[model samples]
Target: MPWEAWPEGGFPRFSEGEREARREKLAALMAENRVDRLVVYGTWGSGDAVHWLSGWPVSREAAAVWAPGEAAKLFVQYRNHVPTARRAVAPEVEVAWGGPWTAEAVGGELLRRGGSGQRVGVVGPLPAPAWNHLAAEVREVVDLTAGYTRLRLVKSPEEVAWLRKGAALTDRAVRGLEANLRPGVSEFELVDAIERAYVPYGGMTHIHYLSVTSPSAPDRCVPSQFPSPRRVRPGDVVTCELSAAYWGYPGQVLRTFVVGTELPTEVRELHRVVEDAFHAAIRALRPGLRAEELGHALEVVRRSGFALCDDLVHGFGGGYLPPVLGAEGFWTLAHASLELQPGMALVVQPNVVTPDERFGVQTGELVVLDHGGPEFVHRYPRGLRLVG
Candidate 1:
């Protein structure tokens, strides 16, 4: 199924087999690099690798120490969090408290496991003190952030299932916003509407950005990173970028809405060009397609004499992977040589705007690449919406 609501008991979790597979992959990478030990760190607001390896969403701080053929030792900070970490981590992992300092705890364990002089592979943003501690114990400390990122590029079946659920919740949130949209509604209230739609089902908010401006005298060309107290007016245009998460996975969708029945001529033209660009990029998406080739799809926007204020496309799910491309003439393309592969998730957002950056419209959603083509993750109704 393309869309799935939260399950009866709670959200589904990755199986033990899945966790082992990820560890095996990481171990293989470590072997290739001749590393003796691997340390995966996780702190509040930044713990993708730790969660992937140990299955414990980081609370304050956490670290997992592993060696070939040995069970991972997970160290969590704040003495009180140990109980939850023990419950959440995989059955094979050994959970412990990091004492007063997590880095020293992990470094002490590394020293005990192999003494000094072993090469260690580090993942995530391990703080400087932790890095120095590890360095003092190991012959060399290698940064394996890129290697970890590469491992996350392709999703397993279980990960894809989680992403599908996230997409459904995200769609529901957008519909919630649309239902409550009307003149005099404050931007903060719009956020409340969105949260109300998915929070009941255990969904968490990843992002809910809003941009409310008068269409006739538009001042904003892109969604604000944070919502404002500005109220929706009769002829106001609202552009939004929302991502509702299921677990750590999230599906992103961008859209524009008008508070009145009629769209301003400039807004209509801009949306038409954006829709064209969205479709063009979707049609060009396929397995084995070079990342730079996808940038060509946005030529229609340039031809229509409209510019873009946001990225035209980017890799999503598991830390914004790669191949972040912008409209041809507007921004530079990164990871241009990358290729789209099956099971990779991407967000194709075409935030079309005028040259003067006065008017704009956002349209797009997350999609997963397949053997044949891209599959839309969201079922939200497409095109510009008219509200009130």
Candidate 2:
């Protein structure tokens, strides 16, 4: 009951009904795909599928076995996390030790649940070694990653609640940046302050704070992980693409700030163009909208005489998922653009760089696609801010 003291009644926690609906959906997907048994496998870095189905945060490695008509069973790497896993997962889910022998543990459970000689499916990107182990016992190994991805494309009520909470913290980080940013303040100091602000919200700041500033050429913005001892001065531009994750769900925002009272005409124009493009993309977000149409929105930046720097939009759930927009020039996990659907969360980062790379404006917000248009999740002001 010690874990019960942690209080799971708030936004990030899910109800039993919500969790059951997810399991039922997974079972239906497996049946449709002719998959007799399905294993949702992942590590801490890629555990969204497992967490989505079982509600347990994977530390090192974990899996959830979905056998049709049987209660889903979760497997964790270490026995020590069993108690915590129990508290994290829904009541009906079964938990077992897995770790060094993950395949064996899951294999035994699947076979016991009528999976012997049945078609097996692996969801998400399971490491080949783990698959080899599972494949040794199970005869047919099918790639059901697409089926799982489709299932996760739409957010559940619980997922939306958690994402909104995470977005609130991301907005708080933006405000924290505004209050602490001043002349002579190192990027390191500002980042530290933002991290502290997330603590009250049960959020953790991403390790890399893209805090970069420019003084001479105030129009340019660049992402930097290594915060230097370099300090801000008057007439400087400070850009931060800050982010935070709450209960494993991540929310991120991009903001550009000027250090001086008078904003330069050149930088102001760049900001105006970027904001206009952002609004256009927002208007384009609706159910049934193809991903490529959203990608075409990137042309707005190019038409405004700016080069596209990042994806026009990217998917987000517990973290960045798939079906990225304007991903033609950038790296993406998806082969083609997917249709926009309600409950899908996105970070619309429309970045524009000058022909000379001397000036740019990058600003965005976490949003959820709705029946109408894009709904703002992180509600901080979208335009460039003048802060001293």
Candidate 3:
């Protein structure tokens, strides 16, 4: 069944209180930066960061700046000025519509807007020209990535509630595929099952990423479907990796399945070793543990004898997945020795290879940290499950 077939309330929206809390946090962030004002840019969901900060998402190539003294303002380009300004912001935030700017025009406006000599901060995946133009002014033009991200890492009560609803709906989608997936099913068909099951509750068009693999073609399966006619076989190792967005927030998940009745001894052992390593990483997860130290804990598994596929564990929330968003390569992880704090959420995946098997297993659980160690947000079987 298509996701549109599901009930309307399957994924719930954040309440009004949630929006207010976000604004309060921004007020605090501006105070902490000690800047007279902060500027943000981008559109669509890429603009979501600023949208998140100011309670407005931009529709045009515009800028939203928050001055510590008065209410925030959103300035837009021509054509989209009214609708973008009117539609993009929270009721509490104010919007300003401005026309297109040439390089000369932008500099003049910044100077006129009390931007000169101010130690302003800018955030987002902005064009170099736009960023440089802003940086060109001021005694200091700081990148508020860390300051903003730190504020973001901890979810508010409302965010937790919104994400939990998304996870539960995703879990239901996985369950649908679990029951119907089999040897003759094409990878594309499986992909369809996942998407069909995800919508109707505000899953929207921010597509999910899917990958499937088999032990034989360890290098070539399920990264995504290509309308393949290839049939699942007895020895195939099935897997899929995904992240789906609800509203503007993202929830990531991974699942593994094996074909046939039994596993080869080598595959079985590799699974067990990686599973143990995953548990070790979980045990080490808690508030006050260093991100690198938590990353280094994966080393214990390597020492204990699981060959790591990669050195990666991460901070995940509010974005789509190509792995690690907001940086180069397929993904990026934190380098600081900072302690993991409460309100932080993470996905702990420790999968690696054994001497004989060319492909190993990757299993994961989305976790939310609390006074307890780490609570699994989306639970699937920890050990491998064989699918016919």
| Pairs of colliding residues, candidate 2 | 219-359, 219-360, 220-359
User: For model 1, how does the per-residue alpha-carbon lDDT over 142-199 read when each residue is reduced to its tens digit?
Assistant: 9998888888888888998889988989998999999999999999999999999988
lDDT of 3 by residue, 2-71 (tens): 3452346332334568866766776677778776667766666564576575544355566676664555
TM-score of 1: 0.93
Better of 1 and 3 by lDDT: 1
Best by lDDT: 1
The candidate that achieves the highest TM-score relative to the unseen native structure: 1
Q: Which parts of model 3 are misplaced by more than 4 Å?
A: 1-21, 42-48, 55-62, 75-88, 94-112, 115-117, 136-140, 205-207, 220-231, 304-306, 310-312, 319-336, 354-358
Select the stronger candidate by lDDT from 1 and 2: 1
Model 1 residue 316 distance off true place after TM-score fit, in angstroms: 1.2
Ranked candidates, highest TM-score first: 1, 2, 3
- Runs of candidate 1 exceeding 4 Å displacement: 1-11, 327-334
The Cα RMSD in angstroms, rounded to one decimal, for candidate 1 relative to the true structure is 2.6
Candidate 3 residue 363 C-alpha distance from true site, Å = 0.7
Model 2 lDDT per residue over 9-51, tens place: 5324578788778778888888888988888887877757888
